[model samples]
Target: MKNNRFLSILFICLLLAVGVSAQNTVKTSVPDTIIIPVVPDSDTIGIARVRNELAAAKLNEANMRMEIELLKYQADAADSLKQAKQMQRIDSLRALTPGVPVVVTGDTLFYLYAKRGGYTPQQRAQMDADAIEELGKRFNLNPDSVYIESTDIVTDIMYGNKVIVSFTDQDGLWANCSRDQLAAKERQVIVQKLKELKEEHSAWQLGKRILYFILVLAGQYLLFWLTSWLYRKLKVRIQKLKDTKLKPISIQNYQLLDTQKQVNLLIFLANIGRYVVMLLQLLITVPLLFSIFPQTKDLAYTIFSYIWNPVKSIFWGIVEYIPNLFTIIIIYYAVKYLVKGLRYLATEIDSGHLKITGFYPDWALPTFHIFRFLLYAFMIAMIYPYLPGADSDIFKGISVFVGLIVSLGSSTVIGNIMAGLVITYMRPFKLGDRIKLNDTTGNVIEKTALVTRIKTPKNELVTIPNSFIMSSHTVNYSSSARTYGLIIHTEVSIGYDVPWRKVHQLLIDSALATEGVSADPEPFVLETSLQDWYPVYQINAYIKEADKLTQIHSDLLQNIQDKFAEADVEIMSPHYMAMRDGNESTIPKEDIKPQTTGTGSTKPA
Candidate 1:
């Protein structure tokens, strides 16, 4: 852009200087009568002589006017010829080069400004021929003797309104070269030098570019291979250490962690090493690329500047021995095992073997989880600053971006996490407790930071978010020791044709006969509703062993069905058909109507 501006300015100055020089060199023709001085021999002009001279000058001016008119006609004829020749030359240039530029005199400012050099041979030859012809016709100069340097057409006001043609020599004999020709020659020389320089440097540049590209590719491959090798070697070494009992398993009976800790440690180390290698590889390759390709200097410098602050701090910190970052990794693994051990101890307590007298049972579990969380959080805090990406602006920006993404896309997830926290503090239920949440009833199997798992009575396991359990109504059957114990209640409807007292007696007998029913509580039955076609009865049985509620419920239902079958009483489910008038006798008025109670209706027959 700057080079273009300088060329534009230089061209304008050359044009202005040519215009001023042309104005100064303009020649005017004069006759002999007009050339004589106005004064006579007295050192002043005599009027009579001056008057005689003026009359002669007037006669001479008349003749000069005729000659000027003839010259104007000739100049006009030359200009017309020049224009026609210029058009022919332009057409030839276009035919030869198609889109190349050919500037002509008398063109508009826009065209003149846009024109450039490097005209074709055909165009230059045609222009030179037409110029010679025009000059010979107008100036009476020999076509062979007139070597036209350049031609310019300008408006001539002095000669009755017509265009005038001017020309100069190509050599120093009759004239010097024109400003435009000198500029064209200078441009050609510079272009040739630039081409030579580019060719001179080409081989060296191409080799350097290829070498740098290969080096970068090789560096990337080497880094990947090294990390992969390190990971595999670390895994094998860990297995060997485990076999030799050099790495002891601190966690006991935890099915998920059977020598898995060592593998986890190895994986974590490999990840750190991989990122370090990537950073180093980039550091080396980036500068090499810029050195080989200097045109991309700004691009490489910009990238380096953006990363320098973050990477510099980390590299220098490590070099300064600012408490070896690997120590944080060691501490993290140590704390992880310690927590696992503590959890193992807790499970031992749950087995009814490791009992602690006078210990607050509810406090132990949440406290253990909190301690484990804090310990891990501290370890992460110690290690975060040392990680490569953590100190980067892009990483910081990514963190905010990730936070926004989580907030927008994971509202339910965050809510569930908060719900888990609430559930932990609320203590609605714990592992091994039979509970119902979100219409699912099961024994609590495991509770984690994010979700709770339950094993249903059918032996199917379900995972529910802790947040959902906290938000919904949860019935924890094992929350409190069964004071009145658990009651398994069931409802049934019998046809109105059966006697209400007989139905009540049947349900009470069925409940008492069921296994796991409490003897002291005694079974009870109630008439709940009297519908148009059936009477509804509810049976309630309290069981001391709440854990056996499923078995007791099944037994109770079986006993009720057996008793009903023996009595020949029909059960009235939603699908039971009502007897038509022709199929069976109509229900009695007293059986259909509910019995009267104290200001309310009671169940009827």
Candidate 2:
């Protein structure tokens, strides 16, 4: 009766709640206003009135807009009229100036000079003939006498003002006198000794060429001898000095000799000397040889122009490209050095010999990797413009193709690199850590861009991609192994007949007997399950040595078997039907006694 009353009260309360919720929802809603206020015949009266007012407003707005547009057009027309008037005034002013030219229309000085000094070919010829006639008239010295003589006229101006005109008769006055004097001298000398140089022109050429060749050969030999002598003497002195310095150290303390270092220093000095000599020779000999040997000057100029011009062009091109290239390279090196330094510092800190207190431990490694990726990407961008033919379509195509290829093929590489960086910053494990990722269990030997190398317990190297390591489940046995120690657990099955307490005792004893097992942690035995055939037991103990894990596990299992044998505990396994039966029975026979005389008795019957 009390339960029924309670149920009835709950049902009544639920009903009252639902009813009150519905009533409140209805009261909060807006009320309808169908009969509040009415403007009768809205379509005929109200809409018509609104339409009439809208039309009037639109007409007024249209008139105002048209007036505004007309005013704007009038303003623009006035501006154009003013511009035209101003242009006319400017033209009138320019027309008034003849010599005082307008600045915008004035000719340059070079043009004026060309106009004043230049003449057409016909005008020049006429001037020459007139000047020649005037020169003949002046030379004849009779003002009324008409004279004509062929002559050449030269014109020049001095000091920007004075003009000098000269005319010389084209007759052999000076040329005749000079030739006559040369002929007289030659005739006087021809009687004693005369050779026909024209007849022996080829032989003379050959002789001259041979003399030049001999001189060149002598000069080359002398230069070679001098250079060779200098080289020999300097090399001998350098060798003596080197021997003097190195011999004592080598004989007394060979370990401290550092001969390779000395050799490197010597090589550097030698290279400096060699470059200096080559530069000096090139500076002096090239110009001197071209200047002295005019015969070969054109060839030398052609060769040098062909070689040095391109070299200089290429050098200037390199100079222009270097700033951007160097910037990218500097950024790359900076990132590389930063990452390397961070790793070094991290290693030092982790080894317990160094500590950077108050530092944000998480920021260093991630920042380094970000800087690395950004710098390398920036370098690629900056270097693109400097590459030869980079502006061409072929280069663009190749660049795009390479970008696509890198994007497609480098997914794993990029993922691994990022994973390595992530691992460094997140610190799931460190070097020398015994970890299990997926199925590979090993100690972390090295971490690189693409993969992490681990040394397994079997002394084999296992290289796992960083992507795999990063994405998979990682069991870091050594992350907290030093503190909690690593739990070495093994599963065993025992027959159900053995008591659970006795099985637990045997497991604990076996784990305790195993080598490298920790005692303070104590051995533990877990009764994992009761199966149809056997009970499953897990023996667990803390073990420290990762390298000897397999040996320790083997020893542990052997110890468990021995311990269970001593405890007389039967380890359970699958049943065998043959072993289960007590006696042997043949197929198609059912408990028949041995009867050898059956056939003989039937025959007698």
Best-performing candidate as measured by lDDT: 1
Counted clashes in each candidate structure = 1, 0
Decoy 2 TM-score against native: 0.46
Candidate 1 lDDT over residue span 285-330, tens digit each: 7766775564565677777777786889878977764455567678
Per-residue error (Å), model 1, residue 461: 4.9
The CA lDDT at 146 in model 2 is: 21
Lowest summed-lDDT stretch of 10 residues in model 2?
A: 105-114
Q: Worst ten-residue run, lDDT, model 1?
A: 106-115
